[model samples]
Target: MRLLVVEDDRTLAGLLHKALTQEHHVVDVAHDGREGRELARSGVHDAVILDVMLPSMDGVEIAHQLRAEGIVTPILMLTARDGLPDRLRGFDAGVDDYLSKPFAFEELLARLRAITRRGAPVEDECLVVGNLVLDRRAHEVTRAGRPIDLSLKEYALLEYLMRNPGQALSRTLILERVWEYSFDSFANVVDATIRRLRKAVDEGYEQPLIQTVRGVGYKIKAQ
Candidate 1:
């Protein structure tokens, strides 16, 4: 899914980008509140991750403007201020959820998934490729009724491949999406994770769903 993240702090914004991208979600970030508002108004995003106390236009106003314009994109606000009135203001402005600063990424991810689910009532929570299944809501993976164990990074990489099946995903693209390091330095990370994925998903199976495109990267295709 594509997402919009509006944050002023460069450091925090970088962290958010790394985290969200690692989960295979394409993220667009705006450091200025006004710029962020413009991006939010584009309507290309599945959801918005907003930070309050922004320069030029605050988060509440951005939310208010988007809502006033009848843009119903789900927004999850992040703020250091956790006062009732602030929360009330945000809610009044059509914010879907709020998370205080210093919060856990797990909680943020949960809120994001929940709000996106609520925003799009018909969206599928589970992803399927052949008999291999990934239940995003439950954070579980199984192949042909057999449970598959994977680390978080492994799960994320597999999900990405499953999301874009049969495509020749390049090493640079996978590196950008799966890990938080530079492609030149972390090129081996993708290879390592792909090996881990094959061990977990193809070790006991007759069909190998994960395939390599020569001179490119990898893909997940059913037999």
Candidate 2:
């Protein structure tokens, strides 16, 4: 799962990032509430870890705005405040779970798992396209029962493509979504990456799953 961590304490944020990454989760860190909000709006992360106190906007207000915008990403709030009123406010603002600071990291991980299970129950952990199968939980891919080895970027690219099976994704869109940032659209990075991905996913197969739209971008079609 991909997660966004909104924390101002650099040390704690780093520790959290490392811990989440160690669990095989992709994590994006934001030191301030504004950046956190923007990253949340990008619709990339599956969940968010928000701090109660932030520089630009407080975590509760951020949760309020996200709820107001109809963004349903699960949020796990980290707060120093344990008062009943404060906890109620967090619930009112749409936080899915709360963790008091100076708490055990294990407890944090457990809460995160609980919230994510509730957040993404609609999404399957395994994605299937024709004979190709990508296991989101195992980080494994197979075709026709044959295992396929993929690099980190290759796996991410393939997962994105499979998610939007028949849609033609623009180069800029792929870069932003898969690479997690913006770059010149004219750059051949997307093309090059797709080339490498095609070699891995379609090279020996009689039928190709990845297709390129002339003058546009790429798509994954079963037939």
Give the alpha carbon lDDT tens digit for every residue of 98-211 in model 2: 999998989988888798788375457788999999887677899898898877678878988888889998888888777766776544888888889888889998999999
> Measured by TM-score, how close is model 1 to the native structure?
0.65
RMSD of each: 5.9, 2.6
Worst 10 residues of 2 by lDDT: 178-187
Q: By lDDT, who's the top model here?
A: 2
TM-score, one value per model: 0.65, 0.84
Clashing pairs in 2: none
Local distance difference test, candidate 2? 0.86
The TM-score leader among the candidates is 2
Each prediction's Cα lDDT score? Answer: 0.85, 0.86
Candidate 1 local lDDT, 1-223, one digit each (tens): 6678999999999999999878867677889999899888866567899999899999999999999998998999999998999999999999999999999999999999889888475445677899998876566889998999988778878877877877888888777555534456677888898999999998987889999888887889943
Off by over 4 Å in 1: 1-48, 54-73, 80-95, 99-114, 121-123
